[model samples]
Target: MFERFTKDARSAVVDAQQVARAAHSDQIDSRHLLVALAESEGLARTALADGGLDVTDVVARARASIEAGDALDHGALAAVGIDLDEVTRRTEATFGEGALARAGRVLRVRRKHIPFTPDAKKSLELALREAIRLGSKEINGGHLLLGLTRAESPGRRVLADAGADLERVRRHAEGASEAV
Candidate 1:
């Protein structure tokens, strides 16, 4: 599948890995891929610009505490009487400050390579499908953006939170892909 990716598409994937690593993420995910696409200097970026969006603002929105889901989960636990905050407080009192926070990550060896999360892999597969659907011989950054828009992933959520119309981006991507 990678063999069919244009240089811009491949670079977006590579840049996603770097984005994940720089953010201290254990694995690359769709949010990182979205960031890479926003930063790409080609069709993907042009499509975004066509929507009157700022590349920096879009990237910032994608990077904005992807832990939003974690916060939602925490709220759900609270509603269920789990009270994670209280749990953390008690655990910290029993052990020490920041004990629970530092439990698993500090002692383990940090990886030199971060693997793609399931959502990221799915997005890549969807990109290929988008390319095929557009009758494009090779996937490009616009196809990657279309892939990100096609699925329910962190990338899509970030775009919504940033006030981007996903359907508009999709149209733009498809147009750009057709042009390519």
Candidate 2:
């Protein structure tokens, strides 16, 4: 997995691990990862803040969800912190019944571990590239947030209504492509 990360991504993962520990969670979920990304000061950080989903707010929502035991399924994942429905839809569409199995697997994975899914990997790559274009040293939570926002999944309309800046995310991706 280290090989899969750019230096900055590895750093983000490290930060996520710390957040997981601080939260007293045995594993690092996407919410923690998003926080790590935001702390890393990447493109998604500014964009997400611009869209009104700041780290403090997201963390509060995640904590509330956890306390409410709302982190049950993918639906719960959204209710807690990662509000990008589009990405959830993509995960469902890409993995289908396998999505449930994979999500379970994700649950079983440790905070120090990175779950593997082709869609997740693709999204991560695209996000990291976007981070690089914004002069970020690593992939951050903002990048993951944008990836989810722009995902062509069932949650698209829901996320748009939530005010996710999909267009800005796309613009960043476009800039990343040009940089590449």
Candidate 3:
């Protein structure tokens, strides 16, 4: 399936891995793939822009989602009547600035290779299917964008949060691919 990917599609996959690593994620998820597609110069980016989505805002929201997951303990403690903010202030005063963030950072395990999450794998497979359905010989970034729009994943949610209409984006991507 990888062999069927065009250069831009292949590059998007590589960029997704980089995004996952930067976010300290153990797996390459749909959000990472979305960021990669948005960052790259291709039909995907153009389609997203045409749908009135800002790539920077999408990236920020995706990263915030990832960070929110990593900080679940903050919410958990609050539920248990613990004040994380006060604790952080005292800890930082005792241990110096950024003590809480530093401690949280230390808990993350760095991996030599991060594998794709199931949704991400499914999205890529869908990209291939989209290419075939469109009578294309190879999967390209446009197909990947179409796949993302079709999938029920965080990437789709990110697109929505960034003010993109999935149907409009999908049409734009298909139109752009036809022009190509």
- lDDT of all predictions, in order shown? 0.83, 0.53, 0.86
lDDT score at residue 29, model 1, on the 0-100 scale: 87
Q: What clash pairs does model 2 have?
A: 8-138, 28-111, 37-140, 37-141, 38-141, 85-155
Comparing 1 and 3 by TM-score, which wins? 3
The order of the candidates by lDDT, greatest first, is: 3, 1, 2
| Candidate with best TM-score | 3
Arranged by TM-score with the best first, the candidates are: 3, 1, 2
List the candidate 1 regions with Cα displacement exceeding 4 Å: 67-109
TM-score of each: 0.78, 0.46, 0.87
Worst 10 residues of 3 by lDDT: 102-111
Cα lDDT of model 3 by residue, 78-100, tens digit: 99999989998899999999987
Better of 2 and 3 by lDDT: 3
Candidate 2 lDDT (Cα, 0 to 1): 0.53
26-74: candidate 1 lDDT, tens digit per residue: 6788999989989868888888888667879989887775544432267
